[model samples]
Target: MTQTAEAAAENLPARRESRAEKLLSWLIRGASPAASHLLLLPAAAWLLVFLLLPVACLLALSLATRGPYGTVVWSFTWANFGRALNPMYLPVLLRTAAYAGSATGLCLALGFPLAYYLSFYAGKRRETLLVMLMIPFWTSCLVAIYSWMIILGRHGLLNDLLGRLGLIQAPLPLLNNGFSVVLGLVYFYIPFMVLPLYGSLEKIPRAYLEAAYDLGASPAEAFLKVTLPLSLPGVFAGCLLTFVPCMGDFLTAEFLGGPRNFLIGNLIQNQFLMSQDWPFGAALTALLVLSLISGLYFYQRLEARQIEP
Candidate 1:
């Protein structure tokens, strides 16, 4: 009877512990919803304060009038926006688009083969090659651009070597043109193109390609029909990444390209710095942001259609 009582005493504590745990879990589930929400609120507030606040300020600055002292006045004017929307700005926008388009295409074309070879063929060296691609990004983009100018200029290695080989009678004109701008853009953005494409291609299960090949489809056919289509999202993402940055890049054009190659970013810079017109600069930024947002929205819809049944 004494042993039985001891067992009952042990069982009572065990039962009590189990009940306490269950009650605590229930309480946490019920009462902790607001506590969890509190965690998310800080990040939301940070974005509002840092990101959205500046955008709000820029918009306000765009709408406000500029005083004689270049101070923002509390007056609404459509003139800043109207100048941005004028037809003269159209060529600048189109030229920027053209340059950005060429660079994006080049990045995709060059990056695809490297990404493919590394991801699929490099085997043990995939990580190493990826590291190499990322290594250039560690250095400032301006430094790499300066290096390109030296490499391609008249007294540069390329021209010197070509002269020795008698391939050209004169030093080639590689700098200070749209071609150089495109080259710089592609060089800077190639890594961006590679990573997203590599991600998409990596997610493509090997069995799908094997199945396609086993079913009498050739290598090219399998890729065209299955692999490429599956990786469309990555391609679109890479294009957008290249396009957006290329559009906003003023430094590349100023350093590598000449008088005929000023883009919207350069124009925006001029308005802000040289002209000392904060309102116009802000207006241009707002318009560019809208264009980017609209582009992304359309791209999302296109992606949805492809993924959906």
Candidate 2:
């Protein structure tokens, strides 16, 4: 063979062998890069056995029929699902949604400024102020409900003050209705809304705000154009957390609002407890989960859109 041709022939096999070795290396990596991932197996098994299994059971109960005694009759039926879609249920669902939405909106309105102030202006006292906010987290939410009752009841503080002022012959209808329920929900959930917003707002680079100021933008303009928009993810996250819990919240509706305001949570609680309708209650629980999941899905979609160009 010619010297050049011999060199080419000799090198071609080496190059081909190198390519083959690389392909083998990639195949080996692709097949078992996480071969020691068996560490996750136990946790996965625990979740399946506990969390997922219970949800599966609840879902099955939703699909199954309720017996005369409200037991889960194994005879499969979609009647429960159909009943949930009825107009009567629709109104309750809508009312709950409206209440939750309003609470979320109010939470954002009230929490946003406080969170911004703490994050941007509190400075050396930020830790102390933030610690104060977390004090409520340590307390029982149920206790707060009772406290609200004491404050909003007929002989409560407002009534005493107003009666002294001769504003009315009787106390206003502040308790035992939708308004107080919303108020309690707002009070209970405001911290949830604040913490997330504060977290997001705190992370906002000082450089961005400085840039806006340096570019001759006013403080108001800097916040609106830079701070508010950047902090929206936290706002959205907090709203979602607050809204979902409020929708499914029974205690707030029951303790403060009493009979005039019965939420879906009350109904579910009744079906399972007093009514002896486990299957029906399970169905109701499933429906609540589904609704929450749907709402979360939409919220996440909106968040994604907010993120996109």
State residue 136's C-alpha deviation in candidate 2, in Å. 1.6
Error of 2 at 71 (Å): 2.3
lDDT for residue 306 in candidate 2, whole number 0-100 = 87
lDDT of 1 by residue, 117-230 (tens): 876799998988999999997779889989998988878888999999999999998888888889999989888898999988898999999999999999999989988998
Report the Cα lDDT for candidate 2: 0.87
Q: Which residue pairs in candidate 1 have backbone atoms (N, alpha carbon, C) closer than 3 angstroms, thus clashing?
A: none
Give the TM-score comparing model 2 with the true structure, all chains together: 0.85
Ten residues in a row with the worst lDDT in model 2? Answer: 31-40
Model 1 weakest 10-residue run by lDDT: 27-36
* All candidates: TM-score: 0.86, 0.85
Q: In model 2, what is the error at residue 201, expressed in angstroms?
A: 0.8
Task: Write one digit per residue (lDDT tens) for candidate 2, span 1-309.
Answer: 699999999999999999999976765666665533454578889999999999998888877776776666876888887887699776776778888889999999999999989998898999998889888767898999888888899899889889999998999889998899999999888889999999999889999999999999999999899998999899889999899899999999999877868888988899889988777777778888989999889998999998774
